[model samples]
Target: MYYFNPDMLMMNGSKMSFEEKISVLREQLASADAVVIGAGSGLSTAAGYTYSGDRFRKYFADFEAKYGFKDMYSGGFYPYETMEEFWGYWCRYIWINRYAPVPSDLYGRLLELVKDKDYFVLTTNVDHCFQRSGFDKMRLFYTQGDYGLFQSCSPGGASKGRTYDNEEMIRKMVLSEGYRIGDHGELIVPESAEISMRVPSDLVPVCPDDGNLMTTNLRCDETFVEDEGWHQAAERYQDFLRRHKRLRVLYLELGVGMNTPVIIKFPFWKKTEQNPNAFYACVNLGEAGCSREIADRSVCIDQGIGEVIGALGV
Candidate 1:
């Protein structure tokens, strides 16, 4: 049984009725001078971008049967027999997660809620949903690497690789075998039994910087690319905080997880604790709550983010 820690409830609204909590949150949204949205995979999950179960089966049933890896996350780490097989798995992974249209308009709704407000987004999620949802690109910082980006997998001067948008590269590799991307984000392999085998060596994407293999620009190690764009976004986030120090700022965290608590949750908590004008709210399904130190001004809702944000009726 999942315990609903009342202490985790934000804004001291543990005892408040559902509608009452929504009212309080709504009022805060309406009155705040600025909002800082912290997001994680759970936000995308709430937006119907799941990585496991049916979604995985739909895209990777053959891999599951062959490799016994059940979900997309597990498959990423699986040791495949050849680069041919590896790129086969990864291109589809990138196309679906990076290029597929979101099923739910949760991000779009959240954008509507804060479109007019002075806002900044700090997110651990790599899905590029903020830009897709029509949020101001200038105000958003994706702390994690994007799926649509590729970096040199080498270690050296070219090691600190610059990021490249790999949309065209991914499309080319996936189609090299005559596999068409399906309408619902799965791969449609050729009628000929061996679709992935025709994947040519030239189809293997390489780093222009170093002539080495290319890998997704995700944060897997110290080599994760932090090019100019990343630093610029980081600077902007810091500037936003400094500029909004005295305003009624709301640090609204949505679906953030424990994978890297310091990135979003811990920093937000510290900021809220230090700034009297800052208010913190965390809306995660079954994971909503704040530390006791910042409890008075926090609003932690133990509910699905889509449900909570939808209730805001933005």
Candidate 2:
């Protein structure tokens, strides 16, 4: 059974009771012509893909000892003295989060809930859980960079952004004499060597015309790539909005935080405000509140997402 701390509940005022919230959600689910799911870090948390604990220690014990980072998210932003260690941590992160099955059935349940509907997902999460859960790829948009994808720093350069083929990179890393394998099959690298290692000059992605180190397509920096796929996805999302402008659209937002309101929360608020027919639903553990303008049409379920999904039987 999943546990929830009462302190995490973020309902600000006496709104609808839990039954009312569930009733409204069921109503919205039944009537929505198109369901748009906006997801954030919380969704993955529900799926048991935490950034710390056994998983973190398994892949990042060395990084933690050397850099003092306690979690994967913090580690990602930590300023490691060298790119090698950074990439090493990131590669392992991508490998596990992207390739490994989630710890729970939460993602699968989410997919089941929306499978029968005309649904599209817009998520800031890079974990690719939706795809792994069997959601149609074409119907989902991962606004943030994906862990599995690598973009060239210069697409046309000789070493232009090539998706770091995981199998290839892992093969190379394992073959390189630099990595140390423990008896438990854990991989380790020397802290000094990590600092000296660059993301291989050759590996640095460049434009097809000019070789440059390829970078993760994440939007954290100016180097984030906006390739053809990005534009196409944006167009599809826009088209969805345009076509469903007058329909009973349901914007089901889950676990969106304030760190990047523009991506999920703000858009949900704006879109719901613009469409009288739209019903905005937010299911966040500790941050489940919405504007008064749409409050009558909103259902803020301040509870654990896993519990919510379980209740839905999705």
Candidate 3:
């Protein structure tokens, strides 16, 4: 099943045809003894979970009209004057990306590609798309914190370093439908209600150990929760790499961008270079290119993740 074709490899030279690229990629994936999937924000974006354009407009039209921002990323960093407004935007962001289902079966198609093979995922996406698509939970290590988990981010609350799944509480908040825009465009909520831009102070989630406000468990700080579950997943990823160090493994990187090249892109290149029996494949639209060092053993498909995954027809 080994299909390591040095001649078919293309570096920064004339690009390989998309069909040829898919063929080589299919062979590598089919023959690999183990597969390590490295995913990033782009992968989720490719799966129709983009944080901008129609998606953002649909979810945050009020915010956009008030703030003059066009996308969710800009809105996430917007200096909202109050925690209520912040949660107004953040909660919806989390709910749509985390709790709600994606528009496409990209993750399902991906699961079918590697379901029977020995595969593990190392992804920076927090959307929980992999698990939602039926991938085994034990085989995943979400390097970044999950959108569904929350922790206290206040200075004093840092010591109360407990993080827990906030899905239930968030569901309650969302289900309450406790918010609306006022005549002046100010976010309005019932004063006594526990969930809204201006709900009662007691209603919002806070640190159980202290009264610090709760925030998503994303990797923005040193205090981001690496709970017992996170550690177990990390150990499993390391073990998977160790067990297949020099075997016929494939490092399948998907839609990884430059935001964190060292995490996924650089490591995949290094691993492929170090292991002659290993093959490396990167699928990114427009941003697909391999370093000259491992170019011979790598396949760079400059096509959208969903398109290529669809082409595989698994």
Highest-scoring model, lDDT: 1
- Displacement of residue 138 (Cα, Å) in model 2 is 1.2
Tell me the lDDT of model 3 at 194.
Answer: 52
Model 1 residue 307 distance off true place after TM-score fit, in angstroms: 0.9
Residue-level lDDT tens digits of model 2 in 99-147: 6556678888888888999999999998888987799988878887777
The per-candidate count of clashes, in order, stands at 6, 21, 0
Q: lDDT tens string, model 3, 23-113?
A: 9989998899999999988889878888788888766777888889998889888888877677767877777788776768888999999
Model 1 bad stretches (over 4 Å):
1-14, 158-161, 182-198
Candidate 3 accuracy as lDDT: 0.80
Task: Put the candidates in lDDT order, highest first.
Answer: 1, 3, 2
2 against 3, candidate with superior TM-score:
3
Model 2 misplaced stretches (Cα beyond 4 Å):
1-15, 154-167, 170-209
Q: What's the TM-score of every candidate structure?
A: 0.92, 0.82, 0.87
Q: What is the Cα-based TM-score of model 1?
A: 0.92
Model 3 spans > 4 angstroms off: 1-8, 11-15, 155-161, 178-200
